[model samples]
Target chain A: MKQMRRRRVRRALEEQCFLWLMRLSLLGAVGVLGMIVGVICWRGAGALSWEMVSSLPEGGFYLGREGGILNALVGSLYLACGATVLALCLAVPVVFYLHTYASPGGRLRHGVRLALDILWGIPSIVYGAFGFAWMVYLGVRASLLAGILTLALVVLPILARTLDEVVEMTPVLLRESTLALGATRLEWMGVLLRQSLPGLLTAILLAFGRGIGDAASVLFTAGYTDNLPDSLLRPVASLPLAVFFLLGTPFPEVQARAYAAALILTIIVLGVSVSAHLSLARLGRYVIR
Target chain B: MGGVVEQPDKGSQRSESFRLSGRRRWSDRVAHRLLGLIAGALCLLVVGVAAALLLRSLPLLSTFSLFELWGGQVWQPMRGLFGYAPFVVGSLWVTAVAMAVAVVPAVFSGIYLAEYVSERGRALLKPLLDLLVGIPSVVYGVWGVLFVVPLVRDWIGPWAEQTVGDALPFLGRTSPSGYGLLSAGLVLGIMVFPLIVAVTEEVMRSVPREMREALLSLGATRWETTKCSVRRVGLPGILAAVVLGFSRAFGETLAVMMTVGNVAQFPSTIFDPVYPLPALIANNYGEMMSVPLYEAALMHAALLLLGVVIIFNVGARLVIERLVRRIR
Candidate 1:
């Protein structure tokens, strides 16, 4: 009993030290990351001005008077909104068709699932290549129309997969409740869609966050130019594309501007994703209205 | 025959159609067909794109002989040579060294938070990792150049030169500018550390409490029980998390493009200029216009990257599959 008591005391002493070390370590990590964001905010946020917000990405400190990111910001908004609309345009009826209409054991259903899984593995780079070929080479739509279409392709699998899950999560009784009442396919789809609208919107917000961060696809297909976009055909900078251009330069002033731009882009994405997460989370208590 | 199967139902529903109008049997059938066709067609796009990428690269399929890509050291684009040896080897070395620097501290810290830390500390520290996740890769590139690069120039470069001047040549060419594997790995490590910590912490928390309690009841130290008992149970998840983080870091582009000295040669030492595969793809994909084969080479490089990411994802899935079994 004396020996056992002595061992217990030693273990307690060691455990206390270990816990302290662990806490200190976590603090150190958090501190390092906090410093990174702090440094960006400290230096980058200073450059934001009323005029700067309206300028194009000219090559000077804050890209000179013309160094503003207004065009790219607008371009991103246009492309993102268009892509989201196109994807939903494509996904809604597809879900209704797949789960509601297709025989569960059919080969076509099996093929569709296999196709999405394969696409998920293909790198974003390859998609850029295809966009270059299909949009610019073959198609007449070579401007923002092409960019939106490419993003639509990139985000399609993710949206479809998420929606499939959401559709599945809807209690079957909700569907059967309408179906047993002799409602046609159209009525059931309308009702079920309204019920799952929040989840679908959440997927869209997530896609927006991803779309803004990606630079590669839009790089070649949405080839950059200096003028304010004359129709969708003219290439303009997006925030990430601006960040890429700024960093790839040799100038110190340009580098600082790039830092500012990157900070803006990251915060914007973080804000959207966080809010979307909360919004989607509200679905847990949703009453369908 | 398929139409006939629905015909009887349609005939029975005609009585109800008297209550409705205009929407006929043929139109409903056409609508069903159109919806199925569109959904099926939409799903085909992913496979189609992947297939298209693979097929277009078939002309140079002869060039991708794995041995040529992996075994040779040369990467001269002008000569139409595509030996991936340099870039491939560089990727492995950088990723491996970076993982060594990242994983050790990340694991211990992750365990600390998951098993040992007070709630207040955990709450404060977790957001930093989230912030790290949120920081743009381009911003990391800027900080690396402005702060990390110069710090290496002043401190690490000279200190290494003095310590190992006669003993090693690595200290000789070490970019006194800090734009080498060391800085690259440092930035990569910082970027990926959050990933491992996040994953390991999650897995540790999910481990049954009984395992930790049994060790504690036996008078094991808290760290001892958590480390040996809990970590053992969650080993596969830890492996998966590390690989996932490393895969992401390996594929990173803009940050590596800005910070990696952007040189095309195989790395000579911890300090030599280098390029990663994704950086190669991003930098040259648009600019290699004077040369046609060069564009093809970039595409081939992209294919190479896609191959690696697929392997990483597949490996992670296998580990996760094992985890699922154990949980069940």
Candidate 2:
């Protein structure tokens, strides 16, 4: 009886230790996020200015002399918007094909999903390299269009897969009723599209967030310029690349600007994420579970 | 058929409706074919990317043997000697270190969220995890440079050197600067932490409730029930999560590049600087285009990175699919 009581005490002690360890670990993880945001905000706030968001970079921007990252800001928006639209075009059809045309238990559906998963895993840098190779073969130069194309490839799988999950969650009875009403597959897809509108919007926002912040894939394809892009063929600056290039300079001012650029990019991403989350909850009321 | 039979009195209306239905069917067939074609093209794009990388890298392959490229230690672009040993080793060391530092804590945190937290707590924490995951890699790199590097240089490095330097030579500081494998690993570990936690939490949640109930009803403690029932059932899924995290950490370029002192060398210790494969490609691609075979060599590095990541991702996905099948 004494031995059993001792064993029970030891077990209780062990449980307490493990539970505390878990709490500490979680605190550490959350602490890391707080630190990242704190550092960026603390460093970036000083460099951010009204003019910085409005004007173009001067001749000596890299030397920390003068200029704002407006060029990069606009360029990033253009690139991300273009890529999101392009990816949406392809991703929507693919998701529709999976749900409407392909049999639920078919190998084709599985194969497509597997392909998308692998594509999603491929690094942004690899996509950049492949895009660069293709541009060279096609006799095209680094430009906004090139970046858009490469970034489209990067976000396609993400858009498709997220939308796929949303579509998968949709009630099957809705589809059966639509088809039973003498509607064709295309007509049924229309209903699915409406039902999954919020999810589709969320997917687009997520993909846009990814596209805007990605530096690796656009490093080679979207050659940075000081001026806003006038044509699809002209080079354009991006916020991620702007941060990357600015931070590399030996000048303290430039590094500060880099921080400011990072802050802006982070804000844009966080905004998109928050909106996506909110919209999902808000618009999801109309969606049949 | 019943509608048509009932509308037999209205013959002209029935015929008009039949024609309309025929046209609708034709359009549906056309749309189906079009969408199917697009999906098929997406698959072709994957194949196209792999083929393009292989073809672009062929020039380097023809010029140098695979053995020379992989086994040689020196990397001199001007001298025309391309050795990938240092980069390969560097990537492995950083990724290994990242996994080591992150796995246990992340798994623990995931379990805490999944099995221990209230529903309200889980809902609040899961979005925070998503936010962490959404932060760009460049921001992580900047954070590393500003925060983690200094912390390592002033504190961790000195403490490590004093306690374990003599006992474990690899733990010793080979370079005074804190930019090296450890810094990169710490930053990358943080970046990948949320991913592992999210995946692990998901996998743990998927473990059936009955298992936990059965174990708990037997008078087991909550911790004991989790360890015996939840972990046992979720082991394969947790493994898949780890592999997915590994693949993500391996291919990350910008953050790793900024923190990992881009010196192309085989690291003798954790503090020694090294260059990784993705960094090798990112840092050199545009500037070194004038050098002979430089582009091809970079392409080869990209190909290598892609191949390894794809293999790992495919394996993890298969494991996940099998687990899902078993659970269902």
Candidate 3:
């Protein structure tokens, strides 16, 4: 009895230690996140100005010039919008086919998803390099068109996979009930689309967030310029690139501007993420578990 | 006879509906074919990326043998010495350090969230983790350069140098500049922490309630049950999460590029500046076009990065798939 009591005490002590370790780990993750956002906000708030959001970047911008990152802000929107549209055009059909045409766990669907997973995992720099190589081969200079295409390639797998997840989560019964109504496969797709509308929108917003913030994939492909892009063939500026270029220089004011750019970028991303989460939660209620 | 009659009646009713919806049927067929074609194109795009990488890399391969490219320690691209060892080694060191630092916190947090946290707490914490993942790599890069580098340079470097530097030769002589493998690795650990947590949490949750109950019924504490049964069952997935995190760290470009002082040297110490493959390509590909075989050399590096990521991803997929099957 004495030995058993001792053993119980030892086990209890071990359990308490384990519990503390787990809590500390949780706190660490939360702490890192709080630090990143809090620091960005603190630093970026000091640098935020009306001119920073309104005017074009002037000459010697990297040398701490007079104007702002407006050009980059607009250009990022253009690039992300174009790429999101392109990705949606390609990704939706594939996701639809995966659910409607291909049987679950079929070899063809599996192969396609596996290929996408591999593509998804390929680093953004590789995409940039691939874009550069393709541009060189085709004799096309760095332009908005090239960046959009590259970003589309990058976002396709992400969007498709996200959409596929939602579609897969769609209760199998929904598909059957719609078919029971003598709905054609196309009509069934419409029902699935309606059912997964919130998810699809969330996916688009997420991809847009990704494309807008990505500096590496678009570095060489989207060749930055001080002016906003006037045509698809013209180069474009992006927020991430602005941050990179500004922070790269030795000037302190310019580095502050980089923080401002990061702030704007972070806000856009966080806004989108939070919205996506909220919508997913809200619409998720309607989805059959 | 009754079944045959019913089948014909059912067939007639279907034919009547089909006749009524002839135009809709044609459009549906068209939509199906169009979607199928798009799917085919999307799949082909992945092939296109691989093919383009190969074609671009071929020129470099034909000019420089693999021995001259990846075989040596020297990496002076300007002088045409394109040895890949330094960058490869740099990537290895950074990834190793990142995995070492991140794995414990990440794995424990994932387990805690899955097993220890209340539902309300899980709901709140999960999104916070998602927010971490959603933050762009560039932002991480900026943060690394602004905060992490300075911290390493000023405090961590000095502290480690005085305390552990003498005992471990691998720590290498500390540099006050702080732009080295250690700084980059620490930032990368922060960047990849969320990924590891998310994946490991999913894997842990899939461990099934019955297994936990069995351990609990045997008078095991929650910690003991988790450690012995749930964690043991989730080990493959945990490994997979770590591997996935490693691949992400290896391929990370902007954050690492900004923090890791871009130098073409084999690092003997964590404080030594080194160039990674992605950083090398990003920093030099533009100017490289002016030099003979320089562009090709950079392309080779790109090819190498691509190949490594693909291999890691494939391995992750296999391991995760096996884990899923085992659990199911």
Instruction: Report the C-alpha lDDT of model 3 over B39-129, residue by residue, as the tens digit.
Output: 7776776678778888877877887788877887887766877789989988888888889889999999999999888999999999899
Model 3 TM: 0.96
lDDT of 3: 0.87
Off by over 4 Å in 2: B1-20
Error of 3 at B255 (Å): 0.7
The TM-scores, one per candidate, come to 0.80, 0.96, 0.96
> What total of clashing residue pairs does each candidate reach?
2, 0, 0
Ranking by TM-score: 3, 2, 1
Tens digits of lDDT, candidate 3, A59-166: 887787799999999999999899999999988989988899777789768878888888888898899989999898899999999999999888888888889888
Candidate 1 local distance difference test against the native: 0.71
DockQ of 3: 0.75
| Candidate numbers sorted by DockQ from highest down | 2, 3, 1
DockQ-based class of model 1: acceptable
Q: Would candidate 2 be rated incorrect, acceptable, medium or high by CAPRI criteria?
A: medium
